[model samples]
Target: MLNRLSIRSIFLPTLVGVALLASVGCQEVPVTGRNAINLVDDQDISKKAAEEFASIKKMQRASRNPAQIRIVEQIGRRLSKTVFWDVPHADWEFAVFHAPGVMNAFAMPGGKVGVFSGLIDFCENEDQLASVIAHEIAHVAARHTHEKYSQGWMLKPLGAATSIGIGTTIGGTGIYVPSVGSTAGGGVTAITQSAFDRGKELEADHIGLIYMAKAGYDPRQSLRLLQRMEEDIASKGGPTANGWLANHPSFPQRQIRINELMDEAMSHYEKGEVSRTHTVIE
Candidate 1:
């Protein structure tokens, strides 16, 4: 049913990609047991992320509140130390911006993280702030963005690449890969990519819960934060949340899935608390 050239185009890249993935892409997400797609190296992504993060920090009005800023850095440090780096390295910084017009936070590769003052307003306590920050860090930890860039041609399955140039899977929706360089037929690609993006957001939520729990923050607070975010988004009635909803699953769906992961996350919290309380002083 297949000839040599056809097989070469199909299986060769897949094999090479998989091999690269084994050495580079097989970064398992902490606590999620998901093996990430390796389209880029951590150092490479972190370098780029650091550049972008610096640019963003310059553009925004950084918060002057010493209290808020200190809190942000403290929480970030607590979580960052627990990161499971196959090649352990520390390059973490956390900042709080005083932009009331914005209500969000994000973490970049290289351990750079930022939170907006407006977002902090919504967070009722240190735990709630931990909820949001851990979620953003989870995105970095999972390498979601790099995996997205890597999904197109490299990940295309050999069997599917025979009929179509390359294909990718997103949220159980398998995209029909277009012929190489054919942007004209990318509508399905966009939609499928979007679905995968939403899936990544949900995955971050799950993993973030574990990170915060392990860091001695209760994961249930994240659920409360999400619940409030949902209400706020509904009230605002638009994309005022800064494209947060655009690539994310519906608020209700996120809430439901977070509810599912609650028990496991709480277990981590209980364990973490016990471990913390019993720290021996020599």
Candidate 2:
């Protein structure tokens, strides 16, 4: 039978390691001020993202429409200026992909933003497009990719520790324990990671609202754009809210959260010079 000293020997170092990791990796997310773990090297992540962004640009067909290019670049320049200090390492570049039916946009680390032609066509005005761009930029600004990697690093060790503890505790007993710790740890990890991703998406929406407002886009357009998207999803029979397993919060839930932050975003919008004109996408 293992003594109390044996348990201490196993756990003490693990506890200390976790504490050291948290202390060294903790960082406050910009705009939201939430403490997040980000252990990945910034330069490495940026370099990889830049490389991937280049690959995507080469593989995907670029939009040849001058109007699409013009609007995206215009909004990109304005939002990039507003977020300069938040993402200092960003070499901001926006590209429009020629996919006319895929309503999506993405932003990578080091400030590579891409908009599918469908998303541009889907937007009713410049402000709506700006809202989506700002949301993607918020993901980069929040360092979510780095945070996700850090979380994976932490979780693997934690799961292994749980398995070890279970094995050690039952070692002397004649009872057969069937890897219960690993199974339970896996379940917990999946649930926790999904919840974390949902929280990050909501946080991005919050940060993006303020960003678009600061960049002179009407903050209310963000709400309108979400409402429209929600309606579209419902019309197409897409799941509105996928409960705990979904990475993104439902459209209605996002709108509700953004509604709470409208007053603050509107104040920023009122103070900013309204230079972003509504460009109707034809």
Candidate 3:
């Protein structure tokens, strides 16, 4: 009983409706307000991060310097108190790895932070170190990595309805792609990763300054740390010699913004009501 014209009318409208729903089903990122296209859930990312973390512990030497570990832990705790008091589930732990050649610091979801010994060489003192930890913390608080995963979920389909259900699995273990470093596979991922990564870095800079100020250190120390890091990298020839430069904003650009925010951060530091005991290390 179906004529060609009648069938065409039904098929065309159904196709358009599906297209519209497909477009609306993508997840939106927190803080940055961008839409993400991902297939994996947060539990997936968290599981992977935990597995990778365990693997790292098996392969690498954690720092033996208890004093240094305590210092870093203190900074992390103070920052958490001010910036992430709402994240009750945050199992905040700071560890110093013994890799002096690998200048790296990164935070996995759920507040697992690692700082390498090589990075300490770049920090002039606690404020500088706090800047690094604060930035990593921002990544976790803002859920930037999870946003990246959500972006991937939208573009790929296990099946339309199945994929839609997975979008709710938004946070999980950190998974890094060995070759391209966690975000090497998709069109949306590449475009948004750069923009989101850069935005998160800038947000960290701003929010980290607030943490530095609240913690009773000169937020200007953030700029100083980046300057020192740039010089250190230049002396070493290039970033390949050190892992600290692995994923970060360029020295000049980050330094410029930090400088711009210095005075405002200093005012907050001066006005902070708490009788803080944080020491400004040389």
Compose the digit string of candidate 3's lDDT tens values, residues 1-282.
Answer: 999987866565455444644764454443344554433455655665666556555555778887667778888778777666533456677777765444456666677777766566556687778877777676666666665554443344423433443223322211111122322222111221222455557766666677678767668777777777667656757655423233556667777877877787788889876556555543
By the TM-score metric, which is better: model 2 or model 3? 2
Model 3: lowest-lDDT 10 consecutive positions: 170-179
Number of the top TM-score candidate: 2
**Candidate 2 lDDT, 1-282, residue by residue in tens:** 879988776666556547757676688898999998776678877777777678667766889999999999999999999999999989999988776555667777788887777778888999999998998888889887777666555545444433321111110100011111343322222212232367888898899999999999999999888888767766655552323225577777988999999999999999977576778776
lDDT of each: 0.65, 0.72, 0.58
Top-down lDDT ranking: 2, 1, 3
Q: What is candidate 3's CA lDDT for residue 250?
A: 64
What are the runs in model 1 whose C-alpha is more than 4 Å off?
A: 1-25, 84-87, 153-196, 238-243, 272-282
What is the C-alpha lDDT profile of model 1 across 18-109, one tens digit per residue? Answer: 77666664667666878767666668667766776676667657789887777787787778876756225538889777755345566666
lDDT of 2 at 273: 77
